[model samples]
Target: MHLDVIIGVSKNNKSGACDVNDIEKLGSDPKVVELFKLKKDEVIFDDDSDIFITSGSTGKPKYAVHTHFSVINGVKGMFYYLEGMPNKENRRIILGLNTAHISGEGSGVLSPLVASMTSVFAPPVYNIKQIVQTIQNERCTDVLFLITYLYDMLNFKDIGEYDVTSLDICLTGGSNIPPKLAKDFEEKFACKILIAYASTEMMVPSISSPWDPLEARCSGVRILPNAEIQLVDDDGKCVPLGSNGEIWCRCCSNFQRYMGNDEQTKAAKSPHGWFKTGDLGVFNAAGVLSIVGRKKDMIDRGGIKIFPADIENVLSQHPSIEQVQVIGVPDERLSEEICICLRTKKNAIIEKDQIVSHLTGKVRLEESVPGYVLIFDSFPKSITGKIDRMSLTKQAIDRIQSKVQ
Candidate 1:
């Protein structure tokens, strides 16, 4: 079937989620049909151990095999600190797109269940109206959602009219959250929002709580008791505090092995058993972790990984186009939104909406392109005159987000 369905299949494979045509499509590629397989070094977790697949975020997607023990550890480590939060089980609304992502079933579902909390499962649609309506209808209290959804929900023009005071805790960070959006949510809700940062390696990076101050709003939160994270440079040595470094975690909650790929296993895990998260983060003076960016050149649409270089090359050839740079920004649905910044140097200038229309119909980027584009007179360059992609990407995301308000 579709690549995204495999996750649904792996979780709730009922209803013949993949039809025959889906099978035919998958059967064409050996890599496609065969995604998860057992490894020689590891057996499935049974009465003795827990086993699961890894969230492949680094170089390639790999399946890490882990056990129930790790799952419990993931949940406990995240919720253990929330004993103090007023148990809002009285009546809470959970806008649940976060669960549909990699962490959807696990962190968003299981961990909350462990806490004896009830939640509502929402779809991946970007309908802010529908989301707000759901909150009003359900009178949901807690929102286990990413930055995109939470940001949009807060901006809903009639939000104050909805009696949404029942909502208390706002969570984010399956991907990036715009600081501006974070600030708006803080003011609108008057409720503290805490960001939870973790990966397929594990879901509870920060102890689940209400909002933190602006400076503490950054995600990929500090290490929990059951986990240990280190920011390391290329040589595998720990980097000093405040320096950019690849985040590595050796945790009791982590997966045990890459399902079938030996090379993936070796590349993902350290000699000492730490799993490299591929995300880059810096520690605060108080030991909280703030994720600055990712090591892999990939974009997160909501929580889905999109490679911009793959899409931009395809978009550049449009008869209306000239040059382009694609990057992701905070999206309410996918943690990140794919945005293209470019110059239309063609004989006929292409309208922004036209470019979106063309790509939606003509290019491989129909689903991957950012919701829109950012055209500029020029792009900032590095000291070496290289286009500063990271800076450009942040700018593009910021520009788009500013318009959302």
Candidate 2:
């Protein structure tokens, strides 16, 4: 077997790279060391080293290559945003995200490594009970969760049985954090929930401070240092403040390019170094940026357009709805129809009329109201723990077809 890289795992299960050139220096058996070590090409570590694979929820997964330069810069960016966070050195953060994923590596490992904090690896399974149990066992002071993971934890019936009070602050991103979920989680866990805006292609750009007001924490995020963000329209021109536009970001931590796909790389990145983040965002009068939805996820019903975030936000407020995802399904008359896929609270009962009635008064546009509602025990999740809208749409369409037969 040939080994290009070696990682040293500590007795405590923490991992770090082994930088030793000669394996025999550690007094290991010479025969065994020679058998394990094969003479390989001396690879140089530079700014274009491959590092991450994107979740690929929108389409095919892409390899996000980062260099030593980008990694260090990302750590610096996280450090800048987390500077004033409470008890930085004392933080024992738990990782709820998958370690191989960018959010997991960045938040669970890189961020803590920069901040001089401890990173606790959660169990392999992404179960809420296991996560809460790890938090209780480790007395974790901080943790990062995807919206789906956080929602599951908050809705867990037995979550109150665990002691999560040791948590000082929690971070979440990848999607708009529902306001109700944020409030309920904070109230129940008694910890400040900090929201961050970032992507695998471009590392941390902005994050809400621990001291931010609830509204600011939920809807707006403070821009971090060493990162530049611009909201641009379809023509790639900067949009006026308060107008929705595609989020374009330039940062030191930005990935070099998508491996093996020059077309995708060119489409997502500009020659000027700005990475088009596909996400739609807006800047308020206060210059605080808030993510609204994904530009590619927009639903066009005939000629009318709808952003799923607007509909999801309204449905998320329903008392019985634990988690909701709005997607566009095919329609013969119209170009597309709105479909609401959701998971209800434990043992909660909901009817189609009940869901429609819940949104009728709140949703302004009649077209925005869901044409179909599909309830499931759980929604499909991407590798990064995000709700997979594409898969959900396919599943909804298949179920509807089956029903027609």
Highest-lDDT candidate? 2
Give the C-alpha lDDT of model 1.
0.63
Question: Which lDDT tens digits does candidate 1 get at residues 286-330?
Answer: 787876666765676655556554466456566555456676666
| Residue-level lDDT for 400 in candidate 2 | 84
**Candidate 1 TM-score, C-alpha based:** 0.61
Q: Estimate each model's TM-score.
A: 0.61, 0.88
Candidate with the greatest TM-score versus the true structure: 2
- 1-405 per-residue lDDT for model 2 (tens digits): 245767543334334557443444655777666755653234344646546878878887788888877877877878776556667787798999887887888778888887788899997677788889999999998888887777778768898688888988889888888888888888888878889898898888888867778878888888888899999988999999899999999988888878777899899898899999999989998889988888878888877878888788878889898888888888898888888888888789988888778778677666446788888887877877787778887899999889879
